[model samples]
Target chain A: MIDFENVKLKIGDTEITIGAVLESNGSTSNLKTGAWRSMRPVTDLEKCISCGICWSLCPEGCIIKRKDGKFEADLDYCKGCGICANECPVKAITMVMEEK
Target chain B: MAIAGLPEEEYLSCGHRACAGCGAATAIRLITKAAGKNSILVESTGCIEVISTPYPETAWKLPWIHGAFENPSSIASGISAALKAKGIEDEINVVAFGGDGSTYDIGLGHISGAFERGDNFTYICYDNEAYMNTGIQRSGATPYGASTTTSPAGRESIGKVEWKKDIIHILAAHKSPYLASASIGYPTDAFKKIRKAIETKGPTFVNLFATCPTGWRSDPAKSIELAKLAVETGVVPLYEIINGKHVVGMPRDISKLKPVEEYLKVQGRYRHLFRPEKKEMEINFIQERVKENLALLLEYAETGH
Candidate 1:
């Protein structure tokens, strides 16, 4: 087995893999796509009815079920698509402009 | 409580580079959930492949392979053969997917060959209408009167002159054991059809209508609503062709269909048909065509052919 830690071999000033193959799966999660957001979805927990429609329809699969049995998006990966807000049957989620 | 009776496990992880509110991404999430953990995914060179696997990063949690745009089906066939050679063909499901550009145009031959050979795999075509990844170029699946970069609606032209290719009928003629048409608008139906397609043996195909907010110039959040409107207006009928028998799904009756204009007026691709002058003739033609298509499917359902 190849040591993933040393898989990248330095060549002068650049680094390259042995065969350019990625052994690690789901590594894209390291990328914080939430930075790409211009709008943020703020959910009202009182009106939110844990129906999971937001979770099911989210393209990023970033929506998580909270401890209170309500659902909200993990802002670390949410791109502020507003799909959850648009699809929320209870109108609990609202899209607000993100402050830089 | 329970996430609407759907699988809680997610195979397509977050933080991938897919566009915000991407219908294809939603479709992929639903598909991977239905395929479960004991499956391998094969993807063609399209939006999903580009976004999901960019260099050393990957969004797929399953064992996935990327093939050329025109040969994912061919690659799937080889994988099926290898699985059979290992005597574990029945233990794993092989799912190959592509965009409309790859499925309805570039990869049609490879898909046909695989189906003709009865390859044990599932081929899904997530059709976003045009080649959105390549800047909205017209493809075989580009609907009639829709403007695109290659088929622009100008003073001299009226968008794509040709009607969208009937890819479902083309695949159905191969006598595949299972074939279905679904849209992201109806998630439950799409999930059921995808599960059925994966469970069925031999070559199975599902044409999933995915919306492109960028290409169509529609509201990103309205992707699912637009998809639903497509079905409600009979623009995209959900149906199944099991062993050469056609079974129409939602919007089964012609009278139940909402006006085709309700679906068309939302997307910017069809905006030209209404602006400068109301292209009454074109709208009428489209409405008639939608009715005719639904009528044909209803007839096929009644005839069982």
Candidate 2:
């Protein structure tokens, strides 16, 4: 949320300024964390009650409520904590391993 | 770690680098939600601090400051004083937090000084028993019979031989208006206490029971379950000492409660205690101590002195 795009770090033997160091307050969204995830959450729309439990429980805020009253996970950010799958009351969500 | 409800807030966002199913991280999320955006979070150097804010990155949405292992209380008191001096004391909430190593051992003097001076702030200690951030070193708050790197259980020793330092009683003796021992197992209860502590004038404290899955040799998914078992077993009593009156928060029926072994069985640190080579005496001692601790808490709750 705060501007930290300018912060960078060059750790190796090359002249590269990797803006990996985030000295900003709440600058986590800049990081596309999908690649770090070993597994991901997939939703079964038919069984979803739109209870918003996963929406509330997602630590990553990757689960979004669609305009049509359905839910989808922004896999680009979801770390597959399995909290959504664990909290789903109607067995609507499942976590599957990410394919390389 | 599943369908268990967390408040609909994104203060501590993902990709901030905390171990999976970290109870301390969970406690941080809950605290931020309760404290809201218009607050100052002062954290001591520990697992939460190290994991949340690695160099340029930070997980906090609020204005947060990092302090040394023994000085969050000192810095928070100064901040609270400065806020009052600027005539906007009510506009900001000053909160300080750290692990049990910082609270029960290292920063106690500063904490006592702040409490004695009546600083306007809320101090929460997420007690994980050991110096987990530094690779499972024993601290004063570590339970007896729990093995650690420093207090390893072997041929000549039975892990940490000392009982947990009674933090609630120590803080209560300071005559702080609000004090409570919270567990991650019962999050609503923890939230209620944190809100109450924030609202209370002057200094307040809450010692939170946070489970360390790695240090405790526990299952990641069972973090909350182990925390709940702690309260249910009376190993960590839930009570708030307000104005010298000890009020019990959640009372378990001791008659129906499971044995202390139930708590130990889930943890790998206590693995030696359950060995088949006959370590019955240590188990019996730990069991007796757990019961004794519960009986003492019940006494405090009933007598209020």
Candidate 3:
């Protein structure tokens, strides 16, 4: 089973961790730069309005909301192009542009 | 052979580290072609100044001077005055170059002063519409609903909450002999405007909408294409106010014009405006503003004032 808590995504060559739960299933590779790193979307829950704008606007459609109504960005399919942060209406998301 | 009907001599070098697909760089290239060899360039503090000249080396091929962030117009005015006093007005043409940050926000005072004095110079604002040198900070020219470092995505704020200042109209207020707006998207038109401004006797102003790849989060190859879309979408109209007369250029078929979505989608700055939870009211507000502004400009042009 995948741990939605420790779930992380790869955007470009950077690794992004989403929540507290960490999970490992398979290896991921960076297609653009050929560098290896995990990427995840970090959210300031205090600022999030549960608007789900990030989920709808995610090009990869990797973001999912929990049963408790809190939205979570799935890092496994997240591309880390920063469109989520750009799309977040309530300024709940920020794309941490990290260098590998 | 002349690249753009000018000599092979270059005023801007290629080694300067501008953001990939920078409109300001392209503006420099075009302005150099129009100004030719006998010109003085005044650069304001912004992306061009910070990236091109890192304390020592500069990429300028002509006589270029760096001024404070808000002083390109004032400094160029001073140069023109001194040149006139020295009886060297016949020897050199004064040209001032700055980004929108310096031109619209910090440099408005200097621009007003020069225009009021009717200084013998041509001022060009390579408008990228933000404080790009400081990590994509918002300025006066940043359109409504566009995100920036200072105007981050957040609740109750749709990015920059203001419309772009009407620079040509403001210059018109100064009663400048020649004033116009151009875009790198329209090279021939831009070239013509630059040449016309330089040839004018008194102070002239040209505000060109240059694209920024890094700040806008767009593809480097699509810089010019995006600039063109800005014009077509009526986001940035191409027109001139010559001797207080408004002359609109290239009347686009608004019927064939693509939705503002197409133009906004390509850049990361407007990414927030394209969401579902994002109220259509916000997007509609922006759309209405754009239409209103364009209509006002068109009306002014139609009225011949």
| lDDT (Cα, tens digit) per residue for candidate 1, span B82-128 | 99999999999999999999999999999999999999999999999
Please report the TM-score between candidate 1 and the true structure.
0.96
**A10-92, model 2: which lDDT tens digit per residue?**
56754323444334677656666777778678899988987776665454556777877778888876766666676567979
Cα lDDT for residue A17, candidate 2: 33
Model 3 DockQ reads 0.01
Docking class of 1: medium
TM-score, candidate 2, is: 0.86
Query: What TM-score, computed on C-alpha atoms, does each candidate reach?
Result: 0.96, 0.86, 0.73
Write the candidate numbers in order of decreasing DockQ. Answer: 1, 2, 3
Which regions in candidate 2 have their CA more than 4 angstroms from the true location? A1-23, A32-95, B1-7, B276-278
Q: Give the docking tier of candidate 3.
A: incorrect
Looking at model 2, give its docking quality level. Answer: acceptable
Q: How displaced is residue B131 in candidate 2, in Å?
A: 1.1
Q: Write the per-residue lDDT of candidate 3 for residues A1-100, one digit (tens) a residue.
A: 9886667777688666662111321111111211211334578888877766554333233456766665666654454545456556687876565465
- lDDT (C-alpha) at residue B155 in model 1: 96
lDDT of 3 at B31: 83
Q: What DockQ does model 2 achieve? A: 0.31
